[model samples]
Target: MSFNNLMIYRHPCIVKYVSSWQKNCKFYLAVEEVTPLSHVLPLLNTLQICVGLHSILKALHFLHEKASVSHNNICISSIYVTRDGSWKLGGMEYLCRYEDLSSDFLNKSRMNRYFKAVDSNEEKVFVNPTARRDFIDVYAFGVLVYEVFKSRESFDEVPNLDVFCDYCRNELQHTDPSQRPILSSILKHDFFNHEFINIHSFLIELPLKSDEEKMLFFRSLVGRLKMFNEEVVASQLGNLLLSRMVLLNGVAQETIVPFLLTPKSDEQEQTDQLFSEDTFKKYISPKLLEIISVRDAQIRLLLLNNFSNFMYMFTKEELQMYFLPELLVGIKDTNDHLVSVTLRTLADLVPVLGAATVIGGKRAKLFNDGRPMAHSNKNLPKEGTPQENEHPVVRDQILNNSISSIIDSHNLILPERSRPDGEEVETSTEEIEQSVDEDLENWDDWDLNENHSILINRLGIADIIEDSNDIAENHSNEGIKSIVNTKGDLARSKKTIADIEELDIKSQVQNNENDSFDFFHDMEPVINSSSKFLINEDNKCDVSLGIDKEVSSKLALNVNDINEEGWGDGDWD
Candidate 1:
């Protein structure tokens, strides 16, 4: 019945349970069986020896201190080896509940002289279950710790090894169980302190025998990745252990990416810092490259989710050379899931690594599967029209458009911000957020290692699709003409339709209701015209539905010609 209660205990130091069955009246419990610890001792390395002693004592400590159970027989023979290259304490059937100081008839079962619990009243041949449980395990553990180091000839110079061994022997064999030292004290012994500062490297390297263990291993690794102070050890664990596990058996990208994006220490629920540099160099880069190489859509989606984080680590050339091709492929992909993920990643990257998305050393080509891919190094079109070669009026027109786009934060904003210098600054929501990486309340005053200028080169959605096919019909033809007449006109139109709408909403919030312009019906972008380039003054260039429209912009061209002598109202053809 106690063993049934004990079966619920889950820890790395305990044997794993799988299933149970009954035959006739007796029941059989099936569990994972492995090599005996007694056989693995001589072959153990320094790290392994430290971890093994820790694990064995850890199980005994948990059993006595946590579960209030006692292993009447505690020794090397009772300790089992697991397939994971670690040790576990088992033989639970010989376990007993911790009782108050009382009689014990355990001599028959306590045959291991090294581990036997003695009583002052030798004839009584009994021990107090409650008082004896923890101390008994602690004393036995001390002996085990001694045995672990006794095999090492190199430890000959370790001054206190023999003395520590003698101390453990005296403590374990002491007739007064109350006099024995506890597990923690033995762990702090000079023998262990000088040799093993940490046992994580040894235990962490052991193979995970099941999916559950693998999951736990990864979660633990990621959890520890935020230990910025212990970065070197953490890096080695992630790069070596994490890489090996992922290669041998893959992990769900969803499961791992979130951990990668937001790292935490043991104290905080949300953390702003991690050993990001080392993590990127060792863990993120290799894992990402390997995962991307697989070409799995779902896995790729997971990768896309974390691409924003990747921007800070990768240089512009690396992103352009490595990431852009696959992203282009994702954009043209027919699979809705892959396309969505790919587009999202690009959408995030454009604002931060905008230049990287431009067709660079390789050109985007229509590939098999009807997707676009980077084919070869070809000259991408140069930016802006050669205004130098155009007529004066055309040259001024290109300049005006260029200046307007730059002022709008690449056409991403609508509302104008008033600056203290009396200059109105209009920028995007992205621009405002980019200045400082504040996350509402949790974070403030910290800036990511990214610049806003990259976003300046980013063409909005309208720009990317403007030359595609029928997308031009949805836009103002006047704006379209300027975009068509000049190279990178589409790229120059920085704001997406959604961005404009958002800006519209924001501007409306700040303005009087009547101040709103009915753009679809009345508002039209005035063409840039000069005295020498004026068309016929008879016809006004109007897109309105035969109605007066609220002309909001100062840059709107006058339909009527203005002369130096006097102003005359006349339509332009």
Candidate 2:
């Protein structure tokens, strides 16, 4: 059978089954062609190997706990590596048994006979078969891990697994499985200690190793484990990898050792153990401080992304005091995407830190530094003085818009105070009032008045005379001056008369305020009386503000339309 057919026929990790069905055969024979370990081992890294080993061990533990099935045939060759670098136990021919089965039976029949025997009597007489077998699998897995670490060399070629197995068999021959050292003990045994030669030196040198070496090592370890049983492979791999990483990083040993060695669990000692100056300098400080110095936006983003995960292994105070400055610098990035992500991270972290001090500090610095917003009026000459004639209104509006955009983009809503302890704390309402007052203090700084005036003029408000009487009064004064100077002309006189007539019309309209009010009140009746009336009224106006006569009449009719729809009768003010 092909690999595809095998995948379809059996478990995912196993190879294709190559056998034929035949009647009158004493027993069935199934042969599986597996991928060689040489082809698989080099693909895994230290981390991947560790994860695979961890998972395998856990799976074994689970099998023992739930199914009570011990897979006694545990070896590197018995484990198959999946294309995705996962390990699975296979090749069960070597499984051990307490009962001797007849040679005429197939491997399955022998397994069944062994399982029956173990289930019947051995479980009660000796340790539970499953648990005992799981440990055996674990032991085998450790050997596989050792094999991978030694680059697939035989146990005798590196450290003899036979010797270790013999030692285990001799020392842990008790009937009670509890008397045996578990997989962890096996891992930390003196035999393994010989394997970890110069552990302290190796760890200390890991940081200095090339990234390529780290990547290759990790890949090879994982790939090798996948060629074996993935579960056992992953568990052993994970533990060893984590152990190496901790040792290499010096984080756990440095932070955990001295305190654990000490007798008293003093508060100060505990605090010191949890946080230290060297801890900050080693992990948090360098990554954060390096962000500012690194010019690449992509690199900065990657750093920021990793910073969160790194900080997860530390406390809140460590993050804030050490890493926050680097995070803040990213927020000021010219790249919109970088700035957006940085701000998002800060927004998330604010609640975690529980204090506004860091954010507040950044906000203050941002405002003080005269950043992009300071150069908002790009139209103005860069070298020009304040008096050299830039429109203040335009400048002010731009500045306000920029500042508002920055603040809004960050979603920096101020915290509301209910008092954390539920006490009725007396805060000065005056401070709140003062904050509101400060909102417009920078209005003149950005030049918004000129912009507002330009908008008003563009809207034709300049042409709309405020009062006709005022126009009339100015025209009369001009005429009087012209006459007094003996410069009065026919054109001037005619212009003055026209101005007076327009003023008279305006004055009449202005003086009839009560009539206008009455007209508004009675508009519906007038409009309903005739369409001619509506058209005649509309034609009198120079410009329509888009209000149709019918709509206007309806609005007039419902002037006190508080009960109409959304308008409530409650005091709005």
Candidate 3:
């Protein structure tokens, strides 16, 4: 029979063989062995269901368009499972026209037997026998999805079956068969949404519940969904499970706000109460961070976008020390979405950590390595050059450490200036130059003093001239007259005379010009010593200068003593 050959070749799941073949027969009769629905249902999961449903929909579309055929028997029962678990629609007995059949007597008998209950009904149903059969098959498929959500026997005794059947009947009552809602609608019913509700609140309310129970429940749900549909499992089941775990871990306070603000009235309030920001920060952040470290770009992007919305929950210290490095690494990702999310998280964190610290530190590192800005300047190399191959991690650590040292030093020095009436005095260039010149003048006066005279001052004449000019320009007649009246000018003159004598002695002795120190080097010690005293207006400077003169006199005496006590071979102190 033509139908038998077509069914055998097209429906691989049909294993039974026809006993005899009749030529010129419009219909083929075949006995096919099929795996029972009970055995097959256990193997179906959300992924398999999705794949199977998609395949069937495509097949149905092809049949309707290309083959000019419609599967009137499209129920799960009519769909046979192969050894490898894939499904194919097997029973096609209802697809042929009356004229295509060889045995009209047998066909009538079958119609009478099958339509007897329908024929007995008094009310006229919108009955095209062909269309009715197809509608019935679609209605049965809807029931299959309903059964999946319920997770019960397909035809078990249940009080809810009557209500469900009534709903299906109402939905299938559309005048145009094609206008009925497709299988996708039936699969995604609001009731099913309620059934697949997030269980976060249950764990929270019952804190004493065993972790084993939670894990069992979670693993079971995820396993089932993963088997049936991986994307659905990832987005719906996996996310829900992660959300619950995150909530239970006390980090939900951060993440739960958006959901709470738009509470689903259909879901229980207790469930809604479980979500919070703290749960998100504590549980979700770490989990996502872990995922980001290991997972592929696609998965990492998915997790990152979901996690980034509540980045404000992380503290500045946490973000800088922990999250920022990971976020920075993500900038190299090829996925535009991931790069955008990583940058957005950084943007949100910048205000919290102080933009200067985060962005400035990044900029500093980029500049150090000669890399262009992450966002700007496309002509710049993305990767570092050989010379610039220094690791950012080590550099960042060193920079942070250096910053800490600076902060500590600042703190240590800040208290000294925190006087109640202390106004910050801004140092002017003129004041600094005046101070330097005063020190130089003091050194000159010290050189003229016999008691304070040294052997080697070697002061720069050019610097002395520069100092004299600076002093002349800054010091008014009134300031100099006041200084001279206080015995300050005499003391300054004495120091300058001592300094000049020391310079004369050094210049007279140094014959090796090429090996000799420069004028700045020779005079630097004297200038530094004098500058400290000149900078301050306190009496300590005068006292320090007197002590310096005394120390110089003592050093001269000690040198004489050593020379006089010499026993010719070695000097004895």
For residues 446-470, could you state the per-residue lDDT of candidate 3 as single tens digits? 3543422121121211223222222
Evaluation by TM-score, superior candidate among 1 and 2: 1
Cα-lDDT of candidate 1: 0.50
Listed in order, each prediction's TM-score against the native is: 0.37, 0.23, 0.24
lDDT of 1 at 47: 49
Native-referenced Cα lDDT, model 2: 0.40
- For model 2 the TM-score comes to 0.23
lDDT of each: 0.50, 0.40, 0.41
Top-lDDT candidate index? 1
lDDT over C-alpha atoms for residue 105 of model 2: 25
Question: Which candidate number would show the highest TM-score if scored against the true structure?
Answer: 1
Q: In model 1, which regions exceed 4 Å deviation?
A: 1-6, 24-27, 100-105, 111-132, 156-163, 190-573
Weakest lDDT window of 10 consecutive positions for candidate 3: 453-462
